[model samples]
Target: MYQVLARKYRPRNFNELVGQNHVSRALTSALERGRLHHAYLFTGTRGVGKTTIARILAKCLNCETGVTSTPCEVCATCKAVNEGRFIDLIEIDAASRTKVEDTRELLDNVPYAPTQGRFKVYLIDEVHMLSTHSFNALLKTLEEPPEHVKFLFATTDPQKLPITVISRCLQFTLRPLVVDEITEHLSNILNKEEIKADQDAIWQIAESAQGSLRDALSLTDQAIAYGQGAIQHQDVKDMLGLIDRTIIYDLILAIHQNQKARVSELLMQFRQQALDVSLVLDQLISTLHELALLQYLPELSLKYSAEINNKIMQLSQLISAQDLQLYYQVACKGRADLQLAVTQEQGFEMCVLRLLAFRPLQPNEILVSQTQVANQPIQPAQQPIAQQVQSIPQVDEVQAISPEPETVSAAVDHLDDEYYDDDPFNEPSAVQAIEDEQSSDDFLEQELESTVEPVQVVQAMVEATPVQPESNADQIVFDPSSDDALFGMDEELAATSPEQEAEKYNSDDFLFDEIAPLAEPALSEQTKIPVQEVKQPEVTESVATPPQDSLFDLSSVPAVDAVETSTVSTMPQEMIDTALMPQDILKLQPQVLEGVWTVDKWEFWFRNSELSPAVQELAQQGVMTGQINAESIFNIPKRYEALLTQLQHALEQALKSEWPNTHFQVNYAEVETTTPYTMQNERKAKAFQRASDLLHNEAAVKDLMQNFDGEIQNIQLK
Candidate 1:
């Protein structure tokens, strides 16, 4: 039978063990000084010689040639222990035999004397898997063992073992073999095997092992076999599922040039070969990191094989350091997210695309040095003095393309002038005042003419009337200055009266009278004359106008009540049909009005208007409300302006300014209400209170003691 390389080359003794000098030195010194502890613990990662060291320590204690530090392999006791036939040297697999009964029976004979060698040795492998009860049973023996017995414990996870057990033992942590160490060891092993292997192949296998000597040796053996007894770089690469370093260089170069097709081709080749997607991403990230390191520190030492070093050097020169750092971050994130993708191919494709998208553009071939002219800030420098006479017109091109600040400022000023000219209310106040006076005079003249004939007839009647008739006429005439006369008229008609005209007359004497102020009598007397006869024909003609042609009777128009309507139209359709429809519909809506009637007639009556009580109250409340609502409506737009404003302010203050403006838009909905209860806090408080009470309760203390059976020496926070 052909013996496998792993078993044929297993270490025979402490001298044969590879890359564990610290552990060997410590154990050898302890044996030399005769100060050996009762128990020894070996801890390390996988394939790092934990079990080997444990076995070596056991053999050192139970050697047949009378307890020497180095076991004499020629003796019968050494041969028996090596062949697993020694009665005193027991090798126990703690992982498989973890029951309390097994541990108890094994340790029951620990107090007895050794039958053969100077000491009986117990070696336990993967001791972390032992049960709590088993650890308790072994703890006593581990803490205080017989003088002739020794215990050796090996584990990967020392944390799982009780602190009491670990504290009693002499713990030794085995370290992983470094790349150089593993490589040197592999080279010697390959030479001993007489396999023709490349130096680069050995280095590749060592790096792929990640720090395990056994793993490196195993990979080296496979590489030698895969290459038909002559290991090569390509054989190791294929065995490890690693992409070629040249291929990575090609991909990175393509990315630097922003060449999409080349990048796609490389990714397709990777897919065709069925390489591991995550591993490819990891390789790309590593390459980028190396490039970054090279750019930042050109003389930094690298551990890559010589076959990869040349490619890395060329890549570092091709891409900029900043860009390499950026892509390195992207590649790292892509590698992490690759596993979450639906398929490895999809993840791999996306990662490649992401790299292509973020890669920097190549610099132009025709490089030029920019120079500052006259210390007036660099203005492209007109292609420099040396290149001004070039045939390419580069100097003229720079001067022609450069924009001056004076020209830009002139253009901006022209735009500002145009904006101001477009404003309808930008006319001077003097001009506006003159226009207003002309319009008011024209209106007053029309009104005076319409009432002239009636006034003349009424004055003639007042003069021709007798004394008793005059007294009655005086009572009917109106001076138009008395508050009582104005108040007595219909409110609708009274509001239409020219209060501006009344302000022209003095009312000091009219207000001092007690018997229905004289202004009332004067206003009544002016109105009592027989003027209806003179205006009968005009009134009949005016009344004959069609309803559609005539404006609504201002005197008869009723005030709008605050009743809800299914369809509300504010301004009359006639006004809308005649006025120019604004280009921006949003700006056409009336923003403010004087009275409730005007507001109802304009903004509040739109059919689709969102007129809630909250919005209406916000609009009508006061100066502060108007300012707050206006800002709220503009900043945090919503139909329910009041509630939305409050919510937005609260959220903004809670999150500081991190809250987004889009989150407070009108289309975004408001939360109706929030309940005031949190289950986590309540449950935590209840649990803490229960624990506190249990600590003080005599009954609970008694119950714990009864159930555990062991004495409660102390209850610690840990």
Candidate 2:
């Protein structure tokens, strides 16, 4: 009878072992040095040489050449072990005989001398499956077995075994073989068996085995029988139900080129095949991630086939890094949410739509400005300025007028008084001292005069003029005595009337000349201004004004009334009292409160609660989307996936503390419909709008604005 490939291809000696050179090397050294332990435990996942290595070690211990790493297979003892007829070597299936009586019986025979082989060998498979009583019975013998006997134990789960029993045995952990190693081994086996196999088929079997050599061999046997002798890529793909690489390549190409119909057709083709949509998406995500990585590290040697390499190279150049990242993220999120959908195809379709939605705009997709936008009638929501003010509160005209200032003081220093002065009547002297500062470049001046019209130059100068203070009587019209202090003037200069100001202005014509460029006015013939015919003040030659800046010294103030209002109160009476109204205080209680856990409330408590860094991050990224009975559904963005693994338990424990007997089901979502951060922002925006509307329509505010010509530049509510 033809034996199965898994059994037929099983390694007979250390040299035949496909992978795990570490295990082989250590065992060989131990056997060569004659330092063998009383009992050996081989631990690993299923089909990874746990029992095979034990059997090989059994033969090594019992060979006719004496205890050696290289067993002489031609001897009767080695032949018996290979043929499963060794009298001295007892192989037990611990899983089936997991009883105290069975272990006692086995230990009862442990002291016996070997009938044929040099030393008796006991090989127990699946040793962890033994009952607690059986373990207890075997513990003493496992720790101190007869010198003539060699005990070899193999188990898939060393963790399940009691530490007391594990401590007595020499343990070797066998690592799972990688795909390349498994594939190469299978290829060699096929060559030895003279079976024709394709590389793709062998690779598929290796991947499907998930690092179990026995499983790979078994899958290879199935593939050989299914193919009737020869293995092909198509047959393997059909058998495994894995979507073809061409399909992935075609789908990505369609997406990158923005061919919506082609993408749809590719997906339909996949759906017709009835392959797992989740796996397809996983492949897409993986491909996109690899493509993005390749953009930076082009020489990265990944395990993709040659047919895929060209597609990756082409798509890497076609899709930008940002687009690749977005596509990958969406694919990952879609795969995670695939189970929540009614059908796999629907979920995949939505994911594809999302990807298409964010696709870089094509030439035709770019919007062009049109004449219709200029001619289109404005909607009421996009009203003109007149209609905007129609809803505003109307201001009553003011009848009150304040007395004009007697002298120039600290207030009007910021005011420009040349030609387009705020007063409109305060033109000063056109002194000859100012005329000397004019430029002598007659040619350049003439060219400028011809190119720039005098009217345009005047308008430009007006535009460039320094901003003047809001010149109203509610604002102090005259500079305060503070200007006198700033100039370090005695009481003599502080009380000068307007006529002295005119004379002082006549004296300061050179100062005005420095600012002529800002006004650029046509010079007047008269050097002195016609002042109001009051008594000409006697010059106080005793105390000379410090300099021209002394008369205009308002440097201490940033605004006209900035210093005056430095200590002013913040808000109006009604607003202050309303804001000062005390909020209801909350007391910490031992028991959980019975209130609706809206996003607002959840965030309020979370804000006040002290939490660990990990749990707080999880809470911030996630939201309590729904609470169905005791189960609370929390969702985070897909990128914050670590929240589900490392921090999930801690986060759930924290939620239980707050709710006191609740469960949390956490999920990752693209967008949160309601979250504390969004809720707070909405409330703040609403509050600002209300405050702005109140300021605009308040009757008292309108009256003040009309009387004082005040403009409300900004209104903020906190």
Candidate 3:
């Protein structure tokens, strides 16, 4: 009979044990110093050398070399213990002898002396399986064992052990083996066995072990047998049903580049090969992690072939840090949600599609572009001129109007004279000043011509001109009397006849409104217009005239009478009143009241309710079964029991604000009735089918199908 590799390659002593130097050192020191405790306990996960170390300790205690850490196996005591035939070293499986009677029976022989060795050793494996009563019965004896007796307890779960029992024993916790340690151990075992194995194959076995040396050895044995004496990388991959790393790298690169067709092709290949999508997703997630690490920490080293490492470096540079993190999170979430998908392949494909769909926007992909605004055709004059001006090309129109810089200044002067002089209400003196301002036009022309760009000339021309185009060009024009026409003078001043105004020119009572409006325009244009002062005629009454320095003194002139009728008001009085209405007093549209919560109205409420997405999912999968007292009971599928409590609380919180008087209870059971989610899906399906029929009946669709032999593979509703 042949022994398995895991048992055959088991360590025989402390020195031979791997990945547990701390435990071995402590036990060795205790034995050498003669400070060994009466009771010892070992704790760790399975296949991590808990029971193995216990057996070795028992051998060290009963060896013929007088309790040495390194036992001489040739001695009768060490050989019998190694062969499991030592009379003094007892090995008991606690799982099989967990009753109090068995524990008491075992303790009855504790006082007896050793039959063949200097000390009696008892090793109990899986000691946590013992009943509570059994532990109580053995605790007093274990705490006060005879000088010649030793108790060694080994358990995978130390948490189940009583604190008192654990306090009395010397506990040693073992650590799980890492990949490198397991790989090295497996390599040494294969070398001793004279088995030829590829490095990649050994690495695969070690990784599959997930930090357990025993599992690694067992996988190695399977690989050897599956490969028929020689372990190969391809054989290992086939046996483990793992996709090739290069394929995974290609898939990642395609997704990062948003190659939808390439991703679909890879998914098709995965389907044909029957590869495990869950494993593919795990590998993809691991690769994404490596990419992120390389981006943030370029100096860090990764465990991959040189070619694969180069690919990682290339991908790190190609993908942004944010996009890489997003891909990683999506992949991890997809792996978790694989069970919820209709199929594993579909889940994996959607995960890759999500990565492609959510890439960062490029420089040119701004949400709103100035080009679109500039290209918009201007609306008619019915629209505000200010709004129309925004869509007009800025520099193009200015440059187009005056290609030559020499005429730019003259064109500006001509525009000014035409705009202001053409108005029927202009003052004679101001128009005369415009005519006189041409003397300095040559100097302005020199400045405008020297400018390099037409845009600068346009800017200078705008600054030189005063009185911008009026926004209210459509309003009614006022009557004569320079001050009254330009400054909106009071009607009383405009109503006075010229003969009466001349008679009252020397009047003592001069209204400030009349004098102030005349002074403001002169004050604003004092430098631009040169006016000579004129003295008034002699009068008996004291006349109120403008100040001595006042430009274009107008007190000598009398007020003119009003024109009986002014230009018609372009805006009607009704329109003005409506425009000036206060916003606070405006009528508000009434909102529809909520209807009663009944079985027929459940779908309507669910669709329109303001609930969180998580709570909505819970509500969608449920139907209102009945109402008990003030509490409404709902039944969801039993499969959602895992999420019942959390979703239940969210549903209640969302409903309490709307239906505060009624309580909600969610129960998990077999759903026999139709759910709101099912009804919604059915309605969507019907709508889609109706749309498809309408589309197919159209003349264009029929012509397209007949002319090109095209088929409708899918219908999408926006």
TM-score of 1: 0.52
lDDT of 2 by residue, 647-692 (tens): 7877677778767658677667775466656655555555455445
- Which number leads on lDDT? 3
Clashes per candidate (backbone, < 3 Å): 13, 3, 0
CA lDDT of 672 in candidate 1? 31
Clashes of 3: 0
By descending TM-score, how would the candidates be arranged?
2, 3, 1
RMSD to the native, candidate 3?
23.0
Tens-digit lDDT track for model 3 on 1-718? 9889989988989999999999999999999999999999999988889888988988888887788899998998888877889998788999999999999999999999999998898999999999999999988998899999999999988999999899999999999998889989988988999999988889888888887788888889899999999999999999999888889889888876667899889889998998888888999998888888887899987666678678878888877676778888888988998999998888888887887787544322222334454455545544443454454544323222323434533444443342344533232331121222232223333223323233333334433434223222112222222322333322433555656545443343333223323322232131323122222234443212223342222222232122111211244644322222121112122324244334445655665778777777777788764442256677778888888776677667766777676678767787787877776665555545544554564343553585458788666654
Candidate 1 lowest-lDDT run of ten: 537-546
Q: Name the regions of candidate 3 deviating beyond 4 angstroms.
A: 362-718
User: Which segments of candidate 2 are over 4 A away from where they belong?
Assistant: 302-305, 360-469, 472-718
lDDT of 1 by residue, 592-680 (tens): 53322232222322212444554534333211112211221222224555575654454334222432332222333332322111222
RMSD of 1: 30.6
Q: Would you list the C-alpha lDDT of every candidate in the order shown? A: 0.59, 0.65, 0.68
Q: What value does the lDDT take at residue 561 in candidate 3?
A: 21
What is the TM-score of each predicted model, taking all chains together? 0.52, 0.55, 0.54
